[model samples]
Target chain A: MKGILKIAFKLLVNDKGKFAALLMGITFAVFLMVMMTSIFSGVLRSASSVVINIGAKIWVMDPAVTTVANSIPMPDFVQHAVRSINGVKFAVPLYSGSATLRLANGAYQSVSILGLDDTSLLGRPELLEGNITDIFAENGFLVIKDSEINKLNNPHIGTTFELNEHRGVIVGIAKVAANGLFGMPTLYTTYNRAIQYIPSARFTTSYVLVEPKSVELVQHIKDEVKKMGYVAVTNEEFRENISTYYKYKTGLGTNILIMTLISFIVGLSISGQTFYTFILENLDKFGALKAIGAKSRELIIMIVFQAGFTALTGYGLGVGLCTLMIGLAKMRLPNYASVVTFGNLGIAFMMVLIIAIFSSLIGVRKVLKIEPFDVFRG
Target chain B: MAKTAISAHQLVKWFGEGDARTNAVKAASFEANFGEIFYLVGPSGSGKTTLLSMISGILKPDSGSVTIDSTAIWTLSKDELADFRLNRIGFVFQDYHLFPRLTTVENVAIPLILKQRDWDEAIQEALRYLEIVGLKDRAQLPPFKLSGGEQQRVAIARAIVSQPDILIFDEPTASLDGDTGKKIMSFIKDEILNENRCVLVVTHDSRIFEYADKIMKMEDGAVTTIENKSEVK
Candidate 1:
């Protein structure tokens, strides 16, 4: 067993091209999954950050607050009731509405307007090209960096804009927006100012932020808030909730699930078939091993190790490519976009690995059937 | 008393079934003592390789049995057969089936490592055997980097590295040119005669006749003749 392992290891390192291709294939798959999931997670995180980053220890929102990227708002009384409970430091009201920003070219790009209090505590851009608090001025508003500016022929920072029947100044240009959620640029302004443009403000979008006395009190705090006819969720839980919804609801989960299954089949066919072909090509070698007193189990281990090594290598290279991809996305994207995660990386690796190991079984079965005697006659 | 390294008593092997079945080895029986160069020679499909495989315990004979060092080789369990092979038998093939990914030294060390020998010790012994084959310089290069002749030498090194009591060769020189083949034969003979290790070779090349201590010819599925082989071919 040790002998076989040593040989298999050496074999993988010897053929640089085939070995590298296998490794890269695996790595690329890993990288793809990791980067895609991470970016997806990152993007959704940014969308939620509108509320997530507000120093809020807990989030109180509508029952459907599983996802906040496009979460509908609840009544102000609910926010007040949750705030009234003990251990709540403060609760602010936040709201979001959608509108179209007109480019000088007479074209329109969709943008979501976020309403914040004068304290600016509910939700705001973490990274912005201009000031976030400037939204306090009735004449002031924040437009996402990607909005009508670059996409619409580079609108100036101080460009005047019309939205929701309210003409407003671009007091500040938010540096980054999240592309994963709603597929629209974002704008930020005062809650009162936002109410003017959106009559639906009577229904508050989300409770701004909460600060617990201590981390240990988070659960109790959440329980008390949840009892008030609102959902209380931690930041991480909130993020996962939104991701889970997108992953399950909207049938995106189904689509992704189908796509994932398709990828599995494709990977299995390509990697597995290639491995089988490689074994067929090397039948003679297997014969030699048999004649040399190698057992069926030993050969099985050998081929399996080969396939596993190839998949591992490919996964690694795939991950490397994904890393480069993430770097590129971070550089090229205007919004705070994310790619894959380590967990996603592991998933891709395991999938490719399973394909690899599964694919090698065919060769192993064939090798086991070879009669060492037949090798001598030919 | 010196024991025979291998003994076969009316061993039979068949293939397929019903109308498709064919007897590959018909009631073949033979024995070779330790340190003798035993030859099984015949044309293609003459059952020379089949008999060799049966005696080597690679196939279970349909009838009779094979005993190597008094152990019923073909009748033993699969693991037992493997253990016997690991501890007592070595094999070389015409194609030199050396792994393309491994260096000569690594290939040679494989058998010993199979027994869980330490890496350093296995490598040293492998190098020692490779040195015997006069190819230590090519040790680090992958088998592909070497010539067909060099690769065969490496295969020899790998086979003999574990110092098995019996060494089997399947058309060991079939793929080599005449000169290289002759050279390999001489090397094999020297190792057998000097080291006292049993060498069984199945071949059509009569040029190796002078190297064998005894030669048997298989005309059909059984041995037709056995030559003393003391006289020069």
Candidate 2:
């Protein structure tokens, strides 16, 4: 078996150009699989970052709020109902609104405005510059993500802009997980102050952010809030809800899945054709092997060794390139949200293995049917 | 006669179907004893190679049986036949069929490796065969790097590495020049043919007929006559 594999390796490497072409095919497939799935995963992560990046243990919202990205604000009094629940450590009304901020150059850019409670400041962006206390100033202050600084006309500390004719001052610059997928900057302000910045029909809160006394009490609190005729979800459950909505309802999942399948097909064809041709070209040699007493099993093992080695080498390089791209993006683009999770790596591996097995079987068909007598025909 | 190493009776093989059917070999009966180089000589389409293939256990005869060393080769199970071939028979081809990617030594070690022998041990034994064939210095060179004569020597080294009881060569000297052909034939006769082995050669090259102890002449898929040389002269 070891000698069989050694022969397989020697044969594959003997022709450098063909080996490279095979490797290239596999690498391109793995690259496509990893990159497409990663972008989809990144989009999901960004969609759920509202729940994931915040400090809340549970969320209370209107029953119609299916996704964090498309939430319908609940009545303000829902916070009172959540605060009354047993095992609830605290409850605060959280405000979220989208508005156009007029820049110093007179251009208007859209931004997501999040309003945390004035007293608790429940979901403040981590301060990279300036003071967290400045949102409580009399004139009102807003915190902007560092990635969105250009959208605010390259604002420095204490630069002020206008939103819906209301004066919006940038008190701090902070690092947030990712801006929305369309590069929408996020601005943080006090709950009441945010309502004044966005033109709306009523002053309603999007969600009630609740902290439970213990992780064990989250279920108890969720049930109590549900009794008030509202939907209650823990942070992880909210993240899943948002991910599922984007995955199914918006057709993003379908697009990524199609791309993944196309990549697999491309890989299969390239590998299959190359391996079949390779075997055909080597048929005389295989006949020679058979003539010299090599079993069919041994020949099959040799072909499999060739396929598996090709798949693994190409996969490792593909995955390595994906990681390098993501790392560079993270360092260069603050709002770049492409996540390559372990699940994505596992799926890509499975894809390559399938390609390996498929191509090997295809190549093996020709070898198994070879007659040792063929070599003697002059 | 010295103990018969191989005996075949009334072997028949056909190709294709309907009007295209043609007998490649028919009712071919022959016996070869140990310690002699037996030659099958004929023109193209005379079924000389086909007969060699059948007797070497590479092709099954349509209606007859081949017995090698007191065992009916055709009656064994498929795996057993394979084992028998690996342990007892060695075939050298006309094209030399050396894997171009492997060195001469690696090519020679294939039979031992197939028998589940240790790799290092197999290579050592292969080197010994290479030495016997007068190509030990070229053991590390691939087939394409060797001259035609050297490649033939390497193929011979590969054939006899396992010390198989039956050795069959299909036009081994067809690809070589007259001098090279004679040299290879002389080497096989002097170094490889022994009392414990039966050596069979299929060839139409009449220049090296002096190396044969027996020559079976064939025409139109049937053996026409058998000549016993008794000695090289």
Candidate 3:
């Protein structure tokens, strides 16, 4: 009713400081949730292509690729049997091993050396920088695009570096459509050289490229690969495997859940407490409103309206601040992206609104208890 | 046989219950007519406030009935009681219960807003009352920023702004000095004589006796006497 609104506005404007603080609390909580969720989504989106970038529609691992982190070595002849399956385009064998990339300054960085088939029809780098002929001809490595490319703090087109106890040249940089799942800075080379660098690496553990004739035949190809005593997974399936590992095993999801809960409690407690005090301070005015013809139900509407407005204002401000933070993050967070999607913003808004409304319940209940007669008494 | 604005019969209100019950207003009865300044005079704790609260439909008596303009409120449901209270009664408290956060005019406009009047119209009406109370110049000052007497006038303005049928005051002059109380009582008397409304004051401030059209005295838990109508106006 008009009377309640008039009074509500007066009360809010009177104690501007308290209400401002309450709105700030709500905004901060919502901002954190929005920012965190966006980052999670962004990282998950880019991490799904680890196997896809190897130009493989169907991957054949040695039945021991345990939950994305595992890469078991399979016998190199598995490619021959996979190529004999119907709807099989071609099969390229890939040998994989890990070693430390020791720079000239002795700073060691972990790298994965992938031994690829030179005579196959799949799995090639899409170069983004430097010369591809130098990379193909010399004993060298190709770095990933969108990565920091400093060699001893200065990047040269033809820099020679010793990595994994062997000296190799940095021929070129290329960006593949897919990146590695386990984040081991993968470098590709001929199958012969991988064994020379890491001897006893005779068998290639995985098949890099196997294109299905049609989308419907993908499952058929996977089933054929599984018959060979190997685990066959599609590109999308491989990405899911990696995502499932970090989400469940690394406890990253649990950390986010806890922080979100903490934000809820903190926002609710502060907003609710101030709202209760606001009601108490204006009890006499409410009683007067009752005396003036405001139904108890009408007063309830006023409370809900105030709570909704506060939440909206807070959400808008919080999102604005979070956007500013994200802009700053893009420049500061080395190769890190904090993605804020529409869905993330929507969910964050809902969270803040729920907290604001829940906190307001206490204050509204107290308002209902005030009696018009109380105004006439002490 | 004047048209009765308020009627209470055998109204009994008790505080607490069982082993600790204290009788506040025991079987009290009264009536008042339109265009009259009525007073309930007594010492503190003499059931004056309890009687006024009952008349205002704020506190329901344990036994007996209250009728406003011949509509028996006791026969109605709780929501009906609230409706009757809100629509028919306006109140002034002893401590000048103005909303300290709002200006004098905004506080006065509250009931009108509660009545769902247009915001500007409500403010205009409230400002009219403020002018009547000689606070037009102080319309924008928050109640807390005003003097004690000015605040009391603002409370009075808020009470009468809606133009209710009945106006009830509980020690409206209690917190003010004698001269200010006299002025407030005179203003209240003029409002009763000129506005065709019923006004009741429950007060221990005997200095206001000259402004009353009728004076009822209470003692213990009952009405003791009714003074004859006066010509204070």
Candidate 4:
């Protein structure tokens, strides 16, 4: 086995130009698959981050609300109906709205405003550089993620911006996982301050976040909230809803899938053609091996080993490159986080493996068809 | 007779179909014995190579039985036949079908590798064969790095590495100069051929005819004559 594997490796690397070309093709294919799929994964991750980070047991919203980013505003009375449910421990009015902040340079940038409960600070961002009390200071205090500081002109504690011509001061720098679907910077503030920041219609709240008395009662609360003609979902369901909405209703999922398939085909073509040609070029050698006592299974084993080695090496390089690019992108862009999860790696590994198995089979069939006597004819 | 090492009974092989059909071999029966260097010499396309192929278990006759060492080769399963060919038969191609990617030592190690021998031990055994073929110094060089005669020697080393009972050579001297061909022929007759192993050669090179213990002359897919050189001289 080791002998054949050594021979397989030698055959692949014998021709330097061919080996390099084969590796390049596989790497490019793997990179395309991983990076393209990861972008969509990252988008989905970001789309659900707000709900995921809030950690609410149940969310009550206007029945028309499809995702956290696109929700219809409900009157504060919705919280009262939600709090009245049998299993509801407490319900808080949650406000979410989009606003354009006029930066220190007078440039406007879009931001998502999140309203946390005033007394409980139920959805407070993790403070990275400022005191929590700074969020309640005078003049519409905004607690922004430290990662988003550059988007807000690298403001200090008192540096101010304007949202809807209302004075907005950055009083706390916090680390938060929330990212809007369209990659808008997030602004965390008290519920009352959020209403002043982005005043809307007669109904101000977008959702009523509920804390179930017990984890087991979440489903019962959701049923009660539904009876009230509202859409109520547990945190997991909300995350799934947002994911399903973006993945299927939009073309994002299909586009990523098509791109992944295209990459797989590209890898297959490049690797398969190179391998077939390699086998053709060395057909006599394989025939000689067969004539000299090597079995068809042995030859097939050699071909498989060659294909496996190529796939594994190319996949490692491609995934490493994709991770590096995402890492660099995250460092430069505030909202770009890696969506290449362990699941994504498993998928990519399977893709390369398919390419390897399929391509090696092609080569194997060719070798097996060769007559050991043909070598003598040459 | 004389303890036949390989026997082919009424072998028949045809190529193509209908209008393109051509009979390559027909009822070709022959037996080669151990302790002799046998030669199958014939005109091109007269089925000398085809007959050799059938005898060596490389090709299955359409309507014949080939028994080597009392085992009906064609009757064995594909895997069994493969193992039989690997452990019992050795072939040296006319073009010296040495793997270009492998070094001389590695090329010689293939048979042992097929036998699932330890890699280091295989190399050691391959080195012994390489030394026998006078290629001990060229063991680490790729086949292309060697000269034509040297490459043929490596092929010979690979062929005999496993010390199989039956050794078949197809046009072994077709690519070598007169001196080199004679030298290779002498090496085969003097060093490789033995009382327990049979060496079969398919060649048109009359210069190396003196090395054959017996020669079977074929014409138009049938043996024309069989001559024992020791008695003929």
Error of 3 at B168 (Å): 1.4
Q: Which tens-of-lDDT digit does each residue in A1-378 have in candidate 2?
A: 786777789899886777888888898899899998998899888887777766588888887887776668777778887888889899998887788888777888888888889899998888888888988875456556656567777776778778888877887777665566657777888988887668776647888998889999988887887788888898888888888888899899999999999999998888778878888888999998888888898999999999999999999988988888888998898777789999999999999999999989988888988898888884
Better of 1 and 2 by DockQ: 2
Which residue pairs does candidate 2 place in steric collision?
A: none
Please state the Cα-based DockQ of model 2 relative to the true two-chain complex: 0.71
Clashes of 3: 4
Please name the candidate that would achieve the greatest DockQ relative to the true structure: 4
Report the lDDT tens digits of candidate 4 across residue range A161-205: 888878888787777665655656677888888887686888888
Interface RMSD, every prediction, one decimal place? 2.1, 1.2, 2.4, 1.2
Better of 3 and 4 by DockQ: 4
Q: What are the runs in model 2 whose C-alpha is more than 4 Å off? A: A140-144, B230-233
Q: What's the DockQ for every one of the candidates?
A: 0.52, 0.71, 0.56, 0.77
Chain B alone, TM-score, model 3: 0.93
Place model 3 in a CAPRI quality band. Answer: medium
Candidate 1 wrongly placed segments (more than 4 Å): A1-3, A46-49, A54-90, A100-110, A119-138, A142-180, A183-185, A197-241, A295-297, B1-3, B136-153, B176-183, B230-233
Q: List, residue by residue over B1-233, the lDDT tens digit for candidate 2.
A: 69999999999999999999999998999999999899999999999988988898888889998999999999987778888888899888899899887888999999998888888899999999999888899989888999999999898888898889899988988999999999999988888999999999999898889899999989999989888765423
Q: Give per-residue lDDT, candidate 4, residue B139.
A: 94
